[model samples]
Target: MASRRAAGRIVRGLGYTSAAAAVGGGVLYLSYRPRDIPGSEAAAVPPPTYGEGGIFRPPSFPNVKTRAEQIADLKRSSGTVSGAVEKAQSGITSLLKGDANDVQESNQGGKDEPYDLLVIGGGATGTGIALDAATRGLRVAMVDRDDFASGTSSKSTKLVHGGVRYLEKAVFELDYNQYKLVKEALRERRYFLDTAPHLSSWLPIMIPVDKWWKAPYFWAGTKAYDFLAGSENIESSYFLTKSKALDAFPMLKKSGLVGALVYYDGAHNDSRMNVSLAMTAALYGATIVNHVEITGLEKDADGRLI
Candidate 1:
């Protein structure tokens, strides 16, 4: 126990030393640099490149309105919220191709016009699948019984951390699948934060440890979680002394408090994100419709899902 406490003290001292050295180095480097060099002048911005720096002419969506125009129209629309929603919906619906404006039109287009992928839900999973299919140049269509994200997608607790609980289970149970789930989730967590800064952000969380003996275990596990994320890891996990943790979050229970594990995950607007996913898929030529019910499934002679 004495040795363990001494090791902890050494680690904390080294951390403080490292932080001070970083600050000193930064200050010295800045002091010695050319004062006249404007930050922007230090780097030349590269010219924007489109289509492999003049490869064979890229395909264009002829007769398609610019996204700016659609957004402008929505912003300029007036009247009730219902009217605005209808107008916005119409704007999105107009982007569909090959008689995708109506389900009846799709039927008229015949068996030849069947979608490559017909996703049956409008939540995160369905919209994500539609987006993936559409981007790969497949004919994609999605339908929902109600508004997008009206179901479980909208019921998220808004914490986008890796399934640390799953990771814990994996560690104890020696389950590889659970570890893979954590890794996959961490990758997605990074992608979500990077791809949609408007709807998502890095959120710091505190896992309070109640006993001195438990702090090392919590720290090791969290550090392993950070390592599993590789480049996608948001922020490294670290120990926070009891006073510091209390300073960060005063409402934390004081009794039996030893320290806390501080780490980052993501927080997001689930509903807005779901809508964006579907709209983005629509922009990529997928047909997305809501308020459409599928009461039964159709099957062929082989009993394939259709």
Candidate 2:
């Protein structure tokens, strides 16, 4: 009975001790608790604690001025920049739009009428001129007995290049138009290759030189041709031994041939090139018609050839 009484007392003691410890912890918490303020608020309200002090405010600009105030401040501080923003916007638009009528539609009325440009011969020269005029915001019409490049242009040496023979002749020799044409042709060649790579590509040519002096001279001129190009699309000019040259081109006469200068230029089936260029021009807002003839040169009231 006595042992049972002792066990009961021990259980009661443990319960009392636990209750006392809990009450003591509660008292400590109450002692250090935040005291209620009598409405003494901070004038500089600390911003709410955002994560890591980085906040995502919804772009609400406070102390934001009205349009009048902003304008007055701008006039006072920076002043007007003339047409700064307008000019900038125009420049950006021009750059982005890529030429004035880049995205414009063509006047198909030329096809409805007799013609716009009466390209007499449908050779490269005429077709080229027609394409140039037509793409540059003019109406164009072409006529031939058959398809384009069916004349002298069709039978040329078939190179869209700086005529190397003329270059050699010009020891005091170079035509300004020819040089300009070479440079322009190189750029145009790039455009053609870019726009229609399958049809237009760089081609290597073999120029047979009979003498050592002629070989170096020919090589130099071709190098200059390649140099004039902003970028070389084909392999640079190199000397080929008689055997190598003959292997490449067996049709040349074996007599008087010392070595040959093999260089690159652009070549094409001129007829196909014309068709492709015409299609590209049409895509870029040029109206083109083939095989249609004009009875007479139409003139405006001012006597300007219409």
Candidate 3:
């Protein structure tokens, strides 16, 4: 019993788990012993390849550590810790892929946690508020009742659209809103589709026209739509005949669909896109969580409603 306790002390002092485990087996593993580090193993470590100009890409995402520093970690132990570190980075790719499986149901943080601003909701609007505030270098906290975008945001028809149909009417009710929505939608569309090409793309939209005169009307209007969208409208608009339109959509009503006015609109996995938005917020160093309850508000001495 005395020997075992002595072994534990020696193993812990050397900061080696294998040596501690070895003591249980009545043998000390030389590798975990500090003495072995300066022997044959120390000489075996190949000089770093960076100075030798070996082919190695930089780490995939954000890491501030240097190449030599990371290489040094690989030499300290078996690749177990290295592999665990890589596994942790794999979660980075999962995050960039916008997987929400990691979202927690309840948070275990602190109350009265210091934050410059506590955003009250976690819908797209609120999330955007938090993100905008955080990116501007503000200390912020955001909360949600359910998984991010478990509200009107998730139900959005998965199109960053500018209301191509309504624009023809020249509706003035929300003209600036329409313009802002169109510009931002297309801009945001380009951002998402570019980063995750495997999941998002520009889908051709075929608006069937029954009258021949309607073809030019739509072409002109849609071209304007393209202009407003700027570079995000990677493609142009065109009119199609009954045969051409049918070729694009076999399921489209053949007889009633007479001819189609084809235009480009962005499409994506709505849930996946929302998840990506949250991940992007995370990447920018924002604190986010899901399934939180906001039961009260605090007011300052100024008598401002909290």
Global local distance difference test of model 3: 0.58
lDDT values, one for every candidate: 0.70, 0.57, 0.58
- Which has the higher lDDT value, candidate number 2 or candidate number 3? 3
lDDT of 3 by residue, 144-252 (tens): 7778778887798777566776565444465766666766767777776666665566677778997778876777788888887777666666667788778877877
Candidate 2 per-residue lDDT, tens place, 209-299, comes to: 8887897687788777767775645456667777767887898788988878867777767778776665544444334445445456545
Ranking by TM-score: 1, 3, 2
In candidate 3, position 262 carries an lDDT of 64
Off by over 4 Å in 2: 1-106, 109-121, 143-145, 169-171, 174-178, 250-257, 284-287, 298-301, 304-306
The better-scoring model by TM-score among 1 and 2 is 1
- Candidate 1 lDDT tens digits, 1-306: 999999999999999999999987864563344433222232233444567757656444423224454333323322121232333344345435442334222212232344555679999999998877655455556779999999999999886778778899999999999999999999889888778877887777789999998987887888888889989975667677789899989999999999888776788899999999988777665667777777876665666544
Clashing pairs in model 3? none
lDDT of 1 at 206: 84
- Model 3 earns a TM-score of 0.59
Q: Number of clashing residue pairs in every model?
A: 0, 1, 0
